[model samples]
Target: MSSLHDRHRAVIPDWITLYYKDPLELTHGEGRHVWDAEGNRYLDFFGGILTTMTAHALPEVTKAIADQAARMIHSSTLYLNRPMVELAERIAALSGIPDARVFFTTSGTEANDTALLLATTYRRSNQILAMRNSYHGRSFSTVGITGNRAWSPTGLSPLQTLYVHGGVRTRGPYAQYTDERFVDACVADLEDLLGQTRAGVAALIAEPIQGVGGFTSPPDGLYAAFRRVLDRHGILWIADEVQTGWGRTGEHFWGWQAHGQAGPPDILTFAKGIGNGMSIGGVVARAEIMNCLDANSISTFGGSPVTMAAGLANLAYLLEHDLQGNARRVGGLLLERLRAVAAGVDAVREVRGRGLMIGIELTEPGTDRPAPDAASTALEAARSGGLLIGKGGGHNTTALRIAPPLSLTVAEAEEGAAILEQALGSI
Candidate 1:
């Protein structure tokens, strides 16, 4: 009989990448570990691209899913959904936008698409500003604004997008500048770009931390500075918090809080961790922007009872247990430990990130050139040592991504760090 991998290869699209040369099929998970099909357990560091906000097989979330499924699987937006309304109320209260309104979708891509629709229609322009090295989503409309070439599949787009600087801090032309100077230069660039564009540019959409672009981000106040410039031009600011929301960043509940001087964004798009592995994504905006549409809009399965139950339970667990505080404590230690380990490895060009989202950038020893091979070798080595991690980068996939669940314990962090240290030594 043909192997499962062979069967997958025959049916699945070639562009859907797998992690290993011989990919391991996950069978089950509990807490911070997952067992492969062959029954080999490995420490899970990437948390399925940071979608699992809490521990794997969390009882609260699992029970909520089961109970909801027993009662009702789904109800379209045409009908009243108690669970959906309750969850939306919670999210709206949490969102800093005044007079907030919420709209649900099944994934981050759909959420961003909705945000784009609202911004473009409300502002009466298809022109947009996107940060360089940013990854929004896989949909056609989103791919147009994605500044990362590796992730963006085509040039054709419904909207006109202008790429901005200041997303990546270490390798750009302004890398050598101080944080203040870097922010100033980027603001100046934005000013110049707006000067050349039409007066009706719709909005500026950006991720608080670029997730697929190797977890890169600008200085703390970069977005605040940009917000000031945007206010002058009447441009809406959309914060894509798919990977950085729900206290994954440790110090802040939302990544945009790191740039809190400007208050909340005009629009916020979130997904991934909110449902704790359940498919729940949404857009939050002020009443005016969200209600701008002249016609009716609804998501058939977006606010399904099952997913809403999962989200409510997951969010409640996250808050009740103070997982954000746990993330701050545990992630701080892990970051320090990883930085120490990277300091001894010549291939590690930089270790950058905040909270639970961290990246280790690999380069040729004693040089600035990207070392994708080194990253690959280290990934395999770490897997061999019974640890599962992830790799990403705009520069040829040369960065290792480490984003464990927010509920990870300190002991788990130490163990993963040790395995990573061994893997780096091999590289």
Candidate 2:
């Protein structure tokens, strides 16, 4: 018999790099568990980068897609579909935003690109402010705003845009002034940057919980104050909740709501969990801001019946099951456990995030300073122990992301945490 790794390597196609490929081959999934080709089951903690909120092959979502596929598969954007309308209405109602209007897209990147285009078109301003370490998408325009220098070879975008420090104000590449004075300084810097620009800014895009930036959640009152600053400068506030939205954050249907009653953003974008991995994305903007895109905007396969059905079914599943509440309750437990585990590890520095979006900041064992590759190595160890995780940070993967599915149960979470503890111990 061939070795598992050898067999997989021989059969696997080579069109793309098998990043982190192991001997195990995932065959199928149900709920939060995945079975490999060898029939050994493993718990799924990463949840397809936090998109599989309702879990894999959810019967309801599958049935909805099947039912819709049987009725009508595709529809042009020029025509309206009931599934689309229903999903939009349900999203609007659950989001607590009256008269919510939605524009559909194929993915998060497309949605972010659409939002950027619409903002520039409406404001007629090329200058925009994106938070430091923020990740919008990989599209050209979205990439222009992404603050991860590793993602962008050039220091800054050639376009007329600026990246302002966000999150807890700190130093280094992902500096987020955590202190009030630092935040004030950041605000001052923003003021100066905006003043230097010839025209007013179009928008300031930020993720409520910096998912790719290490799940950084800024201190309370920051967003409300930032909104005031934007109001003063007549700039739009765009909340990119692609990772934090759709009931994953708990206590709020959208991550923006968890930002401590900060005034509602002028625009909001979501994607990851919206379709439960069915390739759907959209933007919910205030009617006023949306009107800016009314002139020259069109979506081709945006709200197709297939995607719309998935969106509707996913939304219904989330609401009926109160997945958000589950995330909060379970996330709280997970966070507490992670913090306790970190407390025991001299290399563990901090644990941060909201709801199910958790991050473990690792450091050198003795100095208690950041360990460049320690976190990444720990993630590898965790993978070996059958737990999948994501890594984030600026240059070094110093942060470990634990954004499991909303359907993760207490028992599974306890097992994952135990395995994660073992991984940390090994590191």
Candidate 3:
């Protein structure tokens, strides 16, 4: 291991995992590529878990930060912050919720936590409904709602989170069912869960596409059907779009739009890509629910001017250049290419995802069981071939996740896919 990694392990918590057998310290990045501390160049397929929504070091975002920093950085929530307000206004308009109010946080965990806090308090219940394989965040509140055992460090929880069915499409009990039947089964299961559970369930929070649970997603319109059940009980719906928002999913600006038949969620949470690489997490809710909290609260680092400026410029670039369109066109190509490559590989279990968020699941040659070992081999091989990617799955981190910057070009997609093909071959 490198001396830096040794030093990191000595101080940093072991739970904060690093990638690859020998971790890479990325020193700089531009566009879809990054250079490691040792000066090895690699195609960055994960974009730091899709936080770099646009290309790395985009001049617009960099300059905006510089300009904002020159003026000021922090005024706290107590004072007037122009950039933060501007960003909140922009987000409120973009949020599908009517009469929506936005609250910024420092990370996705904080965003989801705030949503949970609002939900339970507004509804006056500590009960929550979460998908069986969903992952929300790493905080106490979020971990309680997260159903994936691998991610949740403890069984103790502040909220009585009820696990529901229907996030994973290919491995769950309802996997064999058709899309129509799958939706029906999941909806039926949800109804049963509600009937069997205690009264006053605050909300059914879900990720449109489960991020850390792999890039798995329920069938389209699945949530719409669930919404019908939730409505009958007056239960709210919260969409955790942390890793799936801002056109990363290509077809929809928000992942919830894939199930738009139910209308927008009562609360929508987002973070990863909105500020490019800057830390920007937030919750958008209708005025009724947001204003429900009686006590005062504030986030010291939530909407700092510097980060808000980065968010504004990054959002503008995403809109003006139609990065969503780029994600669609180039991501579609990459998906097709990966699928073709996976077809000939015996260890490949499935290839799935939308837009730039793709996952290649590895199994034991012919078996359907998760091959985390193979996943590790594939990761190392990919790195050897000068490609940096990511890993995630409920089944012990068995899926290789490829989510490049939304600004990825067709050429970069092809190149990354080619490298992935080689990596899979080696594994």
Q: Which candidate should be chosen as best, given lDDT against the real structure?
A: 1
Q: Using lDDT as the measure, name the better of candidate 1 and candidate 2.
A: 1
lDDT of 3: 0.92
lDDT of each: 0.94, 0.79, 0.92
| lDDT of candidate 3 over 311-359, digit per residue (tens) | 9999999999999888889989999999999999999989999999998
Ranking by TM-score: 1, 3, 2
Off by over 4 Å in 2: 1-18, 21-24, 96-98, 153-158, 168-179, 294-297, 367-372
Residue pairs of candidate 1 with colliding backbone atoms? none
Task: Give the range of the ten consecutive residues with the poorest summed lDDT in model 3.
Answer: 389-398
lDDT of 1 by residue, 51-99 (tens): 9889899999999999999998977999999999999999999988999
- What ranking emerges by lDDT with the best candidate at the front? 1, 3, 2
Better by lDDT, candidate 3 or 1: 1
lDDT for predicted candidate 1 compared with the true structure: 0.94
- Local accuracy of candidate 2 as per-residue lDDT tens digits, 1-427: 8876677668886542343535346788999988778777777887878888888999999999999899989876888688888888776666555467888898888888878877887788888888877788877778888887666645445347687765633444335444576657667777877778888788888888888777876655667668778888888888898998987877677777756556677778889888888988888876767776556556778989999999888888888998989999999999999898888888876788877889887878766366757776787788778787887765443678898889889988899999899989987
Clashes per candidate (backbone, < 3 Å):
0, 8, 0
- Kindly report which residue stretches of model 1 are placed more than 4 angstroms away from their true locations once superposed: none
